[model samples]
Target: MKVERQKDEIVVRFSAGKNASKIQSILDYLRYEELTSKSKATQKDLDLLLKETKRGRFDKIIIEMGLDEKDYR
Candidate 1:
């Protein structure tokens, strides 16, 4: 693999023989890093978001299964 910077962009060059899925996975991680580099979110905000997401999923599952809140308690 060869990486170079030309003008304002960084270019990556690789052989076609390389695994496509592996290359895609690396690109995905790089994209995530590039996107999050400018983010102002804190760990606390992430934790709260995760908590709410889990609670929403759990509530949906409970309702779908015909289960009451006290049943799980």
Candidate 2:
């Protein structure tokens, strides 16, 4: 996992490693939450996120948010 800051947005990168399913689930949950507030997430919103995750771009979000790996255990 790795993190980087880019202007107003933070960048996250993760390899998915051995916990790809878990990671994807968590991402789905987050997306759900974000969409919940707006009632729904458009296809474009999901597509962009999926594209980034496919490229391993979530480490920064984890790092910036300071998620503990053990916490997921």
TM-score of 1: 0.79
Q: In model 1, which range of ten residues has the least summed lDDT?
A: 64-73
Task: Tell me how far the alpha carbon of residue 28 in candidate 2 is from the true structure, in angstroms, after superposition.
Answer: 0.3
Global lDDT of model 1: 0.93
lDDT of 1 by residue, 1-73 (tens): 8999999999999998759889999999999999999999999999999999999999889999999978775
Which candidate achieves the best lDDT against the true structure?
1
Q: Each prediction's TM-score against the native?
A: 0.79, 0.43
Candidate 2 minimal-lDDT segment of 10 residues: 54-63
Q: What is candidate 1's CA lDDT for residue 31?
A: 96
Go through the candidates in order and give each one's C-alpha lDDT.
0.93, 0.77
